[model samples]
Structure formats: C-alpha cells, structure tokens
Target: MCLCCFLDDGPGSLREGCRRREPLWIVFEVSGTINLVSQLSVSSYKTIDGRGQRIKVAGKGLRLKECEHVIVCNLEFEGGRGHDIDGIQIKPNSRHIWIDRCSLRDYDDGLIDITRQSTDITVSRCYFAQHDKTMLIGADASHVGDRCIRVTIHHCFFNGTRQRHPRLRFGKVHLYNNYTRNWGIYAICASVEAQIYSQCNIYEAGQKKKTFEFYTEKAADREGSSSGFIRSEGDVLLKGAQPCLLQGVGENCVFRPSEYYPTWTLESPLDSLKDILQICTGWQAVPRPAEMLIVA
Candidate 1:
C-alpha cells in the first residue's frame, strides 16, 4: 500500500514496500520516529516521499544498492551509528537518483555517500550538521568503476561539519549555490581524478581557513594520477575562508555542468544564499494531499 498506516506490524512493512519490483510511491500515514535496527534497502523505481508530515529515521539508515530511479524527499535522518553507517548510502551501479530536502546529522561515518560506479544523481536543498565526514562521492582509487560517476549538488547547507563537504574521487560533481560555513577541517576535497565545478557558492569560515584541498592518490588508470581538478567560479569567500590550499588547480578543468544538463535552479551567492539556505533548505512542513486526507 502507498500509505504506511501503522507500525504495529513493524518497519518491515515499509521495507517490504521498497523491495517490490514494480514502481511505488511510499508515504507515511503517521508522523513519528522509526528506529531502524539495520540499514533499509531501497529497490528500484521507488519514491519515498516524506512530505506533509514530520518523519525521522534514527539508529541505522538507508542503503540504495544496485537500484535505479529512486527519489527520496523531505526526510530527517539522525543518530545513525555503527561502522560504515551513513544516513544515505548509494552504491554499486545505482543510477538516476535524487535526494532532496533532507536533514542529516550525527552519523557515524557520513551523511551521504555515493560510490562504486553509481552515477546520475542529484542532491539538493539538504541540511547537514553536527557531523564529521559529511559526504563522500567515490569509494577509492582502486575502485576504477567510479570513473563514470556524475553527480550534481546544489542549494545545500553545510553547517559546522568537520570535513568532506564532499571529497570526490574519479567523478564529476557540479556544485552550485551551496552555503558552507564554520567548517572544522577543510571544506571541499578533490582526490584522484575527480572533476569538480563549483559555482556561486558561499563559504564563511571559522578557525580553519582552507576552503579546498587536494589529496594525492594513485589512480587505477596509472596515468598522471596525482590529484583531481577543481574549477571555482562566482564563489564568495568570507571571514578568512582561504581561496583553495592548492592554488592554480581550481582553474583548468574540462568538465562543465551545462554540457551535460541544460538547466538547473540557481541563486546568487552571499547574503541571498545565507538567507535562503538557512530558511528553505531541509525538511519542510507541507499540507497533506487530498488523497491522504480521507476521513475515517
């Protein structure tokens, strides 16, 4: 069923719905916290739409493994624990995914991680806070399968996270209109053949000043695999946000988002970004749809 009316049957009902082969739109009938014992696996062609109600998933998180065409929206994730745990983990050939308006915090490993050949994903309007290792785009240099990964991250608020505002490896990431502030370590990292295009982002720093860093790793290709490429344009740096630790590397990149996807929503940097990202990003309170408003 589309509506998860009760959890007396346990969270398996929702997990089972995600495992179904056919397309499904999953929504909740009740608003509360789901304390998962393990990572919930999401199958293909599913939309976990958490709009109109407040829903929080804690303890364990989600795993999107080898699936495609999934849309996750307006969910709050926190308190994910244990080894290799992430608020959302997409990996091993999954594609065509979108994660929007989610608030993720205090995960053991990372808030979101896309790796192992996964591609064609977009993360937008999400808020990340109170965590280290915020996001990781690729697995490692040995997993050459990550070469085809293409991701777009936009309108996200990275608030006081420790590091990896997304560390990239062997992928192309289009980052735009994101507000990142008060980072503990470095803000963004480029490692091992990653192509990152950062545009119109606002970076406000506290203590740690480096905005970008390059990690050296030997790529599986065995070519000139010293570091990745990052190109930043129209980015605003404020309050001691250093322009990239690796200078001369931010420019001279071939990958551009416009060449792949034609259009995307973008806002001007600085005060506008600070205002909008703080107010509009993350899980929103929306009215329930008429179909779910049935009187019982």
Candidate 2:
C-alpha cells in the first residue's frame, strides 16, 4: 500500500496528524518552515517527500529516534541560528534508512549524525553547506563497541567552513564521488578500525592549503585502511601532470590530486580509469556517482 499527502496545507496540528499515522507518504506544498524541538518521530514505513522547493523544515528537523525503513527526500533543513539544531539525528539500533536529495546547513552538532548502534544506512545526493560539523557516522568508537556503523555516502557535496568531523569512530564506509572544499583539517577522518574506500572524489583546499590527512592512536589503530580508486575527468591533479601519491597507510594517508591526476591532453585519463580498475579488481562496469543538484 502507498500513501501520499502534504504537510504544508494541512490545517490544525501537523505533528498530531503525523503521529496518528504509522505508514504514510507526506508531501510538503507550502514554503514555510516547521520547527521540531523534541523529535519528529517517524514509523518504519514512512516517507516524507518535499514537493520541489515548497517546504522548509526548520528547527532541529527530523530526529529518527528509533525508526527503520524511513526515507526523506528533497527538502531544506535550516537550523535557524542556534546550536544542537541538527538536521537529522539517528539514534542507535536504526537500520535500512535512506536520506537523499536534501540540503542541510547551519547546525551545531552535525548535519547528519548516526549514533548508538545504527547500521546499514545510505546518505546520497545531499548537500551539506555551512555546517558546524558535516557528517558524523559514529559518535564514539568506545560506545558503539569495536564494530562501527556501516554507511555509504555517495555523490554528496560538503562545503566546510571549519574543521568538521566527516566520519568519526571506525566503520566500513564507502565515500565515492563526493566534493569537499575549504576544510580546516582532514576532509574525511577515520580514527578506529575503518575500511574506507574512496573513489573519484574531489577535495579542494583554500589558497596554500593541504588536501587530505588521516590520524590514529596506537590502541585505536586496528587495521584502518584507506584506498583511492579512480579520478574524475575534471580533477585538478590530472591536469597538473605531477607524480601522484597513489596509496598510503594510516597517519600518512594524505593524497594530493595534483600529483596523481596530471592532465594529459593526448589521452583521456578519466575514461581510462574505468577500464583500469575493472581489469585489476575483476569488477564489471564502474558505477557513476549520483548527481544531487536541482535548479528550478
């Protein structure tokens, strides 16, 4: 069964109505903001679809306290000038969740945080701009045991104004085809037992800035790995034609694009990367990253 409705035009109380329905599909038609202080608790089979740019969810936005199979798409979450106004907060034991095609900005804790035993999640095609902390996959490795939550972040853009924690703790994370610019420290940091597969991602620092860095302590360093897969066509490193740092280990996993992705006008290096990885890994066809930008 499928359900579809709008939240903006609904009269009376929106939260009361939403609470009553367990499985629902809500669409936001108006262009106002809604503040959620405690939590906008959703059921397992609920989807909140913001119809185009008509709705803006203000305040702390949706907090999936302990829900599963919930999907949120195509909305803007404004923190509204305060701290801890996180866009989406996923508590522990939440699974099978998807957050796609949304813009979250100006928050204190983080744009999206998965804390306390959360697993099997996907965050794709989202834009996180002007955030206090960009994306926190795990709160603390100590609290979540040795196994950190597993997440896939594909085709997202994070414009960090300051040093933000992209992925904290340790987990199996696939960060593919994302763009990050103007960060104070590491673009993506994996502290403990993290198997990070990064491919076709672009990282740009401000003037006279560095690209990427990784850190780990001796006790927390339990086989944390970082690998660079392939480069995009417009990668600045490819055009510069310098010696690339193809691979490195923890505490030394800093990759500069200009070194590996040097531009060669004669041959298309970007196109060749696809075929190269296939022959080595025996993977059939490479997948293109998601495109999240929508201009109307």
Candidate 3:
C-alpha cells in the first residue's frame, strides 16, 4: 500500500486505502509536504513507513481506532487543528503499537492520546513543539477502565510545549530519558489515582514554565484524596526551574513501575541519558528499512 502523491483508490480516499488493506506496509513514494483534508483511519497489522524521504502530512492527521499491531514512523504531522482531531488518536482498543521518530505539533487537540483501554503502546524518539495540551494518556476522569492503560515514553524531545506532556489518569506510565525544554503550566500531570514513574530526564524550564515533577489536578468534582503517585529519580532541572511534587495522588499505590512489569525497569541514569538522548530525539535519526544502505 503506497500513498504516493495523494493518490486514492476511489471515492473513499487515502483513508479508505488504509482500512481496505490488511497486514500491509504503506510507504510514501512522494517527497516533500502534502496537504490532507481528511484523516487516515489506520487498521490493524499496518505500518506507515516514511523512510528515505521527507513526508509531511498537514491539515489533518491519522487516527487509530481499535487497532493492533500498528507502527507509524518518520512522518511529520502539522497544522492539525479541529475538535476531536489530533496528530494521532488512539482509542481503548488499540494495542501493540509503536510510534517512533515522528514530528507532531500544533494540533487543535492533543498530539497523542491513549485512552479508553488503550494499552501496550510505546512512543519514542519523537519531537513535540508549539502545542498546548500535548498529550493525554487517559482522556477523562471517570473512566475506571483507564486503569488498564499502560504506556512508555522515552527518548523524546518535548520542546516548548504546554502542559499534559502527558497527564495520566490510571495505570502505570514509565517516562524516562526524555528532554523537556521550556514547558508551560505543569509538566507530568497525574490525576485520579494514576501511577507515574519518571527517571533520567532533563528538564530545562523557562522563565514562565512551572513545575517539572508530578502534579495532581485539583478540580471541584474530584475527590480531595484521590491523587496520582509519582516516583522521580535522577532528573536534572536547569536554571529558572523548580521541581514540585503535589500531594494526595496515588495515595495507596506503589511507585515501582518495574514491579508492575519486569521489563519496564530503567537502568540508565540522568548523566548518560543526556548524551544518548541528544541524538535520539526528534526526527534526527530515523530508522531506515533493512535494504537501505548507510554511508560512513
């Protein structure tokens, strides 16, 4: 399945090609920026590959609804602004997903959202900038099903983005080896009994940026005692930055993310993360397909 130069199969458009094809690898043959008026609804067992060339999808983005075994990489999503629209929308039924080396920003909604039972997802090596409400792991406050949502965000660059770098509601989130430069409002928000483990990250908060650690959303309708639990270790906050941990979140929960699942363990410290993550984040080093050659 190749989406080359906005070519569509029929009346449905590029979005339909994604749904009609199964267990397929979609590659972009066209280079440079292309405009999109509609979103591409991704299906299961699909990989959107944007290697070897710069493929930019603007005006709208992609959505993963009840999808599995999906991989999206090396694509740029820009100028996405509308209600219920985002760079990528992952619903509860999405699972076994990997989104890597993508540039997502300036969306009307969140850059990425995993909610309503979405689990087993990994977002890595992506660059996020010029957006507010960047990410939302769990969409709403009342969805008890969110307790099943689990995510891993590593080696990504959160640059000058506003809050929800992501705000979690339930389940365990492991965020490590990430660089956040100049945040807005609060970075790393955990609301409504969420368990967050943050480690080995670099936070360079700007003059107006507030709070690098976990913060609980204090709303009128929420219980005063229901707060998220966050265990932070080996993080570096630069000048004009202050770290704060709010009270009353994940009151009775545990902070050992590795305990929930053995593989979630993070061995890298902050010192080494700064060196490695410097070249990993953004679209700096996109993984080429196996057949592509590398020059020294």
Model 2 quality (TM-score): 0.69
Q: What is the TM-score of each candidate against the true structure?
A: 0.93, 0.69, 0.85
Write down the TM-score for model 1. 0.93
Residue 221 lDDT, candidate 1, scale 0-100? 72
Clashing pairs in 3: 92-116, 92-118, 227-248, 227-249, 227-250, 228-249, 228-250
Candidate 1 lDDT over 65-113, as tens digits, reads: 9999999999999999899999999988999999999999999999999
Cα lDDT, all candidates: 0.87, 0.56, 0.75
lDDT per residue, candidate 2, 1-296, as tens digits? 21223343234334544454467665533445666555566667666666443456666556676678888777777764455556788886788888877777877667788777787788876777776567776666456352546677766666654554366555556556566666655566655444555556655565425444445533333354332221123333322222223333443342332332364122222444433322322111222223432211
Higher-TM-score candidate of 2 and 3: 3
* Models ranked on TM-score: 1, 3, 2
lDDT tens digits, residue span 208-236, model 3: 65654454554335556476777666766
* Model 2 lDDT at residue 75: 71
Off by over 4 Å in 2: 1-14, 80-83, 146-148, 217-296
- Per-residue lDDT for 30 in model 1? 75
* Structure candidate 1, residue pairs in collision: none
Q: Give the candidate number with the greatest lDDT.
A: 1
Off by over 4 Å in 3: 7-14, 212-225, 244-252, 260-279, 284-287, 290-296
